[model samples]
Target: MKKHIILSAILLLAAALLYCSGDRQQVGQVTLEWWQFWTDPAIKPTIEKIAADYEAANPNVKINLTDLTWADGHEKIVIAFSSGTAPDIIELGSDWVAEFSSAGQLADITEDVIKDTANFLGWSAGIWKDRIYARPWILGTRILFINRDLLRKAGLGENYVPINWDQLKEVCYKIDSLGKDIYGFGSNAAEKHRLYKKFLPFFWAADGRIVSLDGKYSVFASDKAYRALKFYKELSDSCSMVDTQRRLEDAFLEGKIGVIISGDWLLKRIKNENIQLDFVTTLIPGPKYPGKSFAGGEYLAVSAGSANKTEAARFMEFITNKDNQLLFCKANYSTNPSSKAATTDTFFTSDVNLQTFVKQMNMSEMVPATPQWVYVEDIIERMLEDVLFNDAPVAESLYEANHKIKELIFKE
Candidate 1:
């Protein structure tokens, strides 16, 4: 009887100790919900590996990732915020940060991020009301992709590349004259959110401003904007086939299109598919010189409603560090790391084609940072469609767009 009691007591003590150990282990463990937009099969693994590595380093932290698509991600995020079920961290397009930050949906992270502005580019995309709400991650820019064979067949040497507005127009016309069902330019059609990006570069290259620096009014009705629109219409009507960006890229790949302005995603597709085509990328030709291209990027932001703000911020800082960002950028071939040090890696410095992108990115400009930009983008797209497709007068279209934008910005 004494032995039985002693054995039972020992087993009870052991069970109690194990239960306490398990309880203690759960005390400091954290699970974070992370929503991101990189859904490519080739790139998703790298993203998972990044999160896994972060978890391995910080054993008490866990990340649960949810993949989002560009098509529906914005709508889903808005719904999540409204339902009070937002994630701990979100990977937002650079254009979206301002909208969320200004609406109080994003956590203000100015003090949590690095103070060195030179270390990362595109900081303005993440700032709203002078407060930083996101960290720039992957940066990319659009450049002109030329079909070398088309240029040569058009009686221009392979070495011939457009350097200015007149040269570009002349080259495009020459290519169009080939008359074998080939197009000189791949112009974007009425893509609601996209046509504005294609059009704004021309506007900016012609020295157009959409709004004043104070964000108080629209300056989009200037002669520069009208001139830009007139030129765009001429180019589109003369030698271009208008289509969605995807169809345009497919046409470019099929050798039916001569020149197209596209970002690194196209580059990645070409390299990945091992397509055999002679082509080169160049900066967008300007009215007088090489013009500024549109700069776009991915950014990381903590959700204002996250329960684990500190842990979320730490994870963001970790993943955006030089080494991790370089890894991510390497896996995503056409993208540059936001980290300045990562760009110094031989991977970027050694490639001549990538150097073209680097040069263009240096001269690129982002759209204005404003919560009203979504409405403004829609208005501009409508204005372009009016002139480019509906035959609306360019000057009148600009006046209407400028008026609508002014109402959106200055309205009470």
Candidate 2:
């Protein structure tokens, strides 16, 4: 009996040693920290699958993904950078790339990745001071969302989508005349940062710019800018501006709003909520040209302080390549592929509704790539609110905003 007990003890010790050795192998492997905010219940699994595939292909390297919430993700990123614990690969919002790259926190990948970026609609957002610091991963755009039922009730045909700003106003007024609490258009008011994107298309179509080419001056007080602002104010007056985008969308979903300019996320929400409403999206009505949309997207950037930059870049390239991008965008219905091949894939071309946003990509433009963009955008939002809500003159409000932004741009 004593001999048998000693043998059993030796066997247990050997098994424990073997298990620990395997654990140590995994622990010793190079693991890159990936911080991302695609935490939707449905989309999270797709990301996990991608990570698993990447790990299967490269056994020597592992990815440690930390899911983030949109509400506090930016704050958390700033904290991580301040504490010297930033992740190796970070997924940044379209507006955040310039802010981070300008701070010298992002690795320059101009020569190594996507050298010919003219094909990507939102590529300019990832560049800071003429240096490419991030790769465009997912692209999307806003279109004019129309309520077909409301149009029919207003004695308009289902195919009566506006082709220009003048037609939009005429249609809006016709719908507003329907009475019974129905509104012509739903425009956002007083929402910080959001107000800029909502109105930027108009300014861009009018050939107005938010900043100088060198990004060192504010050009918001130009004649074209004033024209755009005046037009927006007049449109809002006709539509009856709502205090928030959410309210605007809700009104649209309820069939109380005849028209609204909204992002593809609204389409996803409409489908998920199963709202019994007939709606369609089209290119936003333009002034000087056809309608234009905001080219919004997400970007992947390697941290300047990351020890595993090569691995991070490899993973980014793998995921954003044409095939993978097409797969990912297919899963996320509202997302448009950033790659040229993915953009032309049958997945997009086959669906007429999807093609609307895909076609708008040709007429889309990204916001100014400036480190001070956040500050500049805040001033413009206030200017918009002053004219749209406070009844301030468009020219005067724009002049004040231009002056404030000039101070921010030229400040030492």
Candidate 3:
């Protein structure tokens, strides 16, 4: 009888201890679910290390990272929000932020990030209706990558950099005259999501705006748009190889193409692989001088339905801070930190090629922050296809595209 009583008491004590331990864990611990799209084997380790460091600093906080792919991340995020199964934090592409912000699926983080706006770049990418819903993490811009050897062979000095459209045309034509196998310009083909990026810089250079600030109407059918399209079509036809961005970059690397508008990824590839190609980076030549290019990057946002909003916001801010951004950008090697101070570091300033990209990034612009931007970009791509491939009149294509975009924006 005594043995039975003692065993019962011990059992009760063990149960009580277990209960208290579980309760303590529940009270003191916080886990934040972060869904991100950095899946590269080389880069994922850096992300993991950063998360581990953050966890070590905050002992009670845990980061639950979920890797996502660009191919279907948007669709997964939409489903998560609709089902109320969204993670606490999400890494969104610059173009995807509007759809989530407009749907009220993203937490309003203006108060958390407003004071730091001056310290960071590309805030326009994260702001919706004057309210910031995300923090820009890494920024990137497209610049002109020129083959120095091709320029020299064409009788243009190896040091020559085209600063205006006329000079660029002359160089391109001179290079194209070299041979049938070698092209002058690497023009983007009818790629669904890509052709618009290549074409928008020209449109923007000509002072074209896609939609009004209020998002009430389309302002894309102006004389500037028509002129930009006509010029782009002429340039492409005269001395360019129409291909996908990947093929274009490959051609540039193989020294088969003279000039292409490419981003930092190609720069990193060349440097890392020690390619023995003679190339220089320059700002995209415009009608008069260097013009605006496309600026876009990764953004971090807190989910509106996340129970751990405060913790998620803290982690978001921490990861996007200057030091962390520099670390991540350095590891990625193909992106610029969103932090203004981070860019001033010797990592970027010491290299003339990187400096060109930084300069272009400052002059770059993002697409309009509208929820219907996906459809709008589709229309823009189709319009370019019509003019470039179908030989449709530039003005007629612009007018039709403008009408379609207006209907998409103001439809009842």
Candidate 4:
């Protein structure tokens, strides 16, 4: 009996040693932190699947995805970076490419990976100072959205969606003549930063480019910009619902407006409801040039100080790939395709209007990738409201806008 007890004790000790050794080896696996602004119900599941599949393939690594809204995403990411808790992989707006990259908060990815940017639209929007920093997972560009149902009622449904801004205005006049209370065209002219989102599309149609390629200063006071602003004010005079982009989006979902310039979210909203709404998208056209729109997209980046950079980057690559992007887009019904092959998915390729956005991706010009651009945009937004709502003359107002922007940007 004594010999048996001693043998049992020895076996138990050996078992404990083996368990401890195995645990230590497993501890070396990495955990990567990824952040994004995808709180929409349709989007969360797709992102989760991507993360799960990636984790399954990389058993040695773990991905932690943090999702938020656009406003919330910007605020929280700024806070996290400030608090030194930035994630390994961060997905942000192109508008923020300069803000975060300039602060030395992002990893320099120019030479770190092989990229086929030519195959992707808006892929080059996030570059700053000739260095690649973040990569886009999804994108949105401004496009013309017309309601065929309303156009038909106005006796203009015969391929009613126009090819140029002037034709669009003519169509609006026809609709306006139909009723006093109803509007033929409506755009979100009152939203804060959103004004630029709407205005840039029209401005570009006038052969106007908002940002200088050098990323130096605001060109909003240029002749093209003045024409864009003046034209916007004129459009609003006949349109009802001078609401924010959010409201314009909501209004579009309810089929309350005739036409709008909006993002992919509007497409998803209409499709999800199975509304028998007939709609189409077209390029903004100008006299001497084709209409242009702002091209912007969502990007995923790794934090320079993250403990899981490698794992996070790998997850980003997997998520942004064709298979995962297609799955997510098909399930959600609203995402802009990121990968070249993903655009061929029957769900997207079958829709003519949807493809217009994908095509516009090529003609898009990214917003200025300068650290001071946010403040500059703010100045532009406020001045636009003044020009539209107030009696401020265009030239004086723009000069003041330029001066005010210079003050805010240069104010230490």
**How does each model score on TM-score?**
0.91, 0.90, 0.93, 0.87
Q: Model 4: which residue pairs collide?
A: 284-291
Tell me the tens digit of each residue's lDDT in model 2 across 1-412: 9999999999999978876797767554679899998888878888888888999999878889999988899999999988889999999988898888988899998876756485555678888877889998988888888889988988889888888889888888888888877898888877776888888888887878878877767788999998888888887886554768999898888888998888778877876888788887788878844967778788999999998888888898888888788778777775577887787888888877788888888788888887777787788888888888899988888889989988887877
For each candidate in turn, give its C-alpha RMSD to the true structure in angstroms. 5.7, 7.5, 5.6, 6.1
Q: Top model by TM-score, which number?
A: 3
**Residue-wise lDDT of candidate 1 within 205-253, one digit each (tens)?**
9999999878777999999998888888888999997999999999889
Report the CA-based lDDT of candidate 3 relative to the real structure.
0.90
Whole-model lDDT per candidate: 0.88, 0.83, 0.90, 0.74
lDDT of 4: 0.74
Pitting candidate 3 against candidate 4, the one with the higher TM-score is 3
Tens-place lDDT per residue, model 3, 22-67, is: 7878877999999999999889998999899899999999999999
Q: Distance (Å) between predicted and true CA of 14, model 4?
A: 19
Q: Give the TM-score (vs. native) of candidate 4.
A: 0.87
Error of 3 at 161 (Å): 0.6
Better by TM-score, candidate 4 or 1: 1
lDDT of 4 by residue, 231-296 (tens): 777788766557777776666556677777777777776777766667777765553346777777
